[model samples]
Target: MLVDSHCHLDHLDLSDYQNSLDRLLDTARQRGVTQFLSVGVDLPSSSRLVELAQTRDDMLVSVGVHPLQRESPPLPEVTELLSLGSQPGVVAIGETGLDNYYDKDNAEWQEQSFISHLQAGAQLRKPVIVHTREARAQTMAILRDYASTSSGGVIHCFTENWDMAKAAMDLNFMISFSGIITFRNASALREVVKKVPLENMLVETDAPWLAPVPYRGKQNEPKYVVEVAKAVAEIKGVGWQQVAEVTTANFQRLFLP
Candidate 1:
């Protein structure tokens, strides 16, 4: 069985699925995607994710604002993050971290939000789901300062050097690969995947985006995580089945009850 370690379920374009979330998930199930972590990027999405997971045994969730998300009046505070993350079925604290690649001028706000989410994760004893891009140093520094070994997290959609990957592993963070790893231009990322231990790796589609090759430029779904697994298997010189078993286990070990 495969687990989509990260996805934005609410953002999926379900037009072809008769606008039915169940239908989309049914398609994923047929592809051996047995479980999903529907990630949240902000307060509203987090609330929606909690509602979505409430009745689905196979679905779990993470809550926090994305680093690039502009802080609005409704942006969750540290206490609010703690409260939401404490809710049942909320297995992780964030899809949070710094992203200087997008908006360098807002570094201060991003750091504030990132630090708050880390604090919430630390306090609630829940793992965080991090998203770092072009801000590796700041991201690792914040994580090293706040993320305890007991409340470790994963760096989602990793597209970084081996140095960054090693730094994250040192902090007890698993490195999750998305379809981006399957791109022809992602050779460096592929090398990082090769070096990361199987026990410390996870796979995701980040569905509704970053669809793997053969499905690239089309809408992505959890079903396509198998392609990512297949790629990782090839990179690590292991069988695809081994990738499936190990990543599923890693997801459960890190985020499941």
Candidate 2:
């Protein structure tokens, strides 16, 4: 089985599936993507995901305010995060971290929110689901300071260098590769994939976005995670089933424990 470790099910264009989440998930299951982590970008979305996961044994959820959510006033406080994060079926603390690529102006706010999520994760003993971009150095520093090694986490949709990957892994975090790795211009990212050990790796589609090649430009879905896994297998010089087995094992170890 394969797991799409990061996806926005609520944001998906489910029209093709008759606007049904169940139909969408059935398609993914048919493609061997049997598990999903529907990440949240804000409080309302987190609440929705929690509700969605409650009845689905194949689904898990993460609660947090994404760093780019400038509209979320007053930043995210540890108390607020703890309250939502403590819910059952909520296996992780964030789709949180710094993202300077899109909005460098909100760096301070992002850092504060990131720290709060890390604090909540540390307190709750749940792993974090980090979404970092152009702010690698700061992201690493904040994680090193606020994140607990025992709680751990995964650097979702990783597109950084080996140094950052090594640093995150050293902190007991897994590095997840998204469908971006399958793009023709992502040769550099594929190189990074080659160096990352399968034991510390995970695969995701980040669906409703970043659909893998052959499905690029189309609305992404959890079903496309198989393509991401196939890409990883090619980059790692391993069989596709082996990549699926290892990544599924890694996901269970980090999120299902």
For lDDT, the strongest prediction is 2
- Model 1 lDDT per residue over 76-151, tens place: 5999998889888999988889898988998888888888988999888889999988998899888888887786
Off by over 4 Å in 1: 71-75
Q: What is candidate 2's CA lDDT for residue 159?
A: 96
Error of 1 at 181 (Å): 1.1
What TM-score against the true fold does each predicted structure earn?
0.97, 0.98
Assess the local accuracy of residue 62 in candidate 2 as a C-alpha lDDT between 0 and 100: 95
lDDT of the candidates, in the order given: 0.90, 0.92
Residue 141, model 1: lDDT of 88
